[model samples]
Target: MSRRTLVAGIGNVFLGDDGFGVETVRRLSAPGAAAARLPDGVETADIGVRGVHLAYQLLDGYDTLVLVDATARGGAPGTLYLIEAGADGPVAPQTPVLDGHQMSPDAVLALLDTLCAGTGAAPPRRIWVVGCEPGSLDEGIGLSPPVAAAVDEAVRMVLDLVHHQDEETPQDEPGVAAN
Candidate 1:
């Protein structure tokens, strides 16, 4: 069976390397880009700084969700990490905050959990996060040199996660384990 997958890029373009996700998806969706060759049932969204929108969109239902964003874990700036969620089940937050501007993937998931429960919508069956260690998130309009160089690799990693689950690399590598 084919999987309906949403690959969402979330972050703030003005916050230096935080734009990593935004830029990566831009390349992925470009004409003749690698994602163009993928089969149907895959969609890409540049949900820049709009975590609430992402959470609401999830209510539409999907088999899989892949979120790409700048995730900091004290590694080298270009290091990549893949985190899996939804396999275990949706989050059960004690007190969820539904911030309109909560852009981090975790916060989005928390908000999603609440939404799905209230609306009786099922969350994605599987979720993955393709993250890049950022050189800086300070106010800026562009990525640092290292983070900029990592965008291509990040795109490849996202594709790999979407197509080949067994070959995922971050199971060995470590990062923020949640969200």
Candidate 2:
């Protein structure tokens, strides 16, 4: 497959704002979604709470991988952060805990590192985390008000990355993609 970019969304929908990634990707994949017009080779998936599954999917080669998730960084809820991580990964400092049931981006990256070692599948050249500050990770079905509102912006951010990455370094405010 000529998958150039993979925008994977992973999170626990049962936990309120923690579902941001899942929701954002849902919007991005909608039939008429703004990001739907992306050129061929960009792929998106809603990998809800499946850390191990994401690790295995890396077997397919992609030059860039953009992960969308809810990050609790002690910032205000709904805040957006675009962090570009090295090949070793963004959460390399912390020890990754491998759990099929639960895995943070850190854990996922660590698992991928190990997989690449044994399988010889090269990891993506660039990795990015488009994260949103979560309000409540508490057990719940719906997102908090603030988090729900930020979904649109998060979608735009992902669109920006896949659209402009090859053209130039992504800007803080990415330009609108031409039709």
Candidate 3:
């Protein structure tokens, strides 16, 4: 069977910079936008702050999951990062704390792990994160200057990732890479 991929954008639009994921997916899924250029069997959604919902969605059985979000890795704002989840091993389960208002990527993954453990559902075969370094996640609307500037680039990155022709070579450690 061909690979099934889900590109989920996670974050809150009300919060500054945190909306990177949501905005990127918005552009991708926009009418006559980049999403139409994607290959078949790929789906995209803006799963904002809904960790539980996202976890449940994962149970549908996709071969790959590409999560787009703002990740603070102590880098300059607007820096893009490509992270391969479970690169080492299964993620350790964290205490289940279901917050309806907010859910970080880590939390969502942990929740998925827990949910899968009970249902015998195998997690996605591969997971990648197209993350951006946020300038600020404080209460506000829209993205910061640098982060805003990176949106188009992030969209391009996600497209490349979904196409399985990522421009950057995989590295041993997930570090800040060029946009």
Number of the top candidate by lDDT?
3
TM-score of 3: 0.87
Q: How badly does each model clash, as a count of residue pairs?
A: 0, 0, 0
Ranking by lDDT: 3, 2, 1
Candidate 1, residues 49-83, lDDT tens digits: the string is 88788999999888788888888877888788777
Model 2 lDDT per residue over 1-179, tens place: 56499899989999998899999999998888566666678888999988888888977878888898888777788887787766342456253466578677778877888898899999887888888889999998989998898889888888888988775467675422211
Alpha carbon lDDT of each predicted model: 0.79, 0.81, 0.83
Ten contiguous residues minimizing lDDT sum, candidate 2:
170-179
Clashing pairs in 1: none
Per-residue C-alpha lDDT of model 3 across residues 1-179, encoded as one tens digit per residue: 87788999999989899999999999988878696888898899889888778889999988889999998888899988988887777666344448755566777788888888999997887888889999998999989999999988888878878776333444322335633
Best by TM-score: 2
Native-to-model Cα distance after best TM-score fit, residue 163 in candidate 2, in Å: 0.8
Q: Candidate 2: which stretches are off by over 4 Å? A: 1-3, 87-96, 174-179
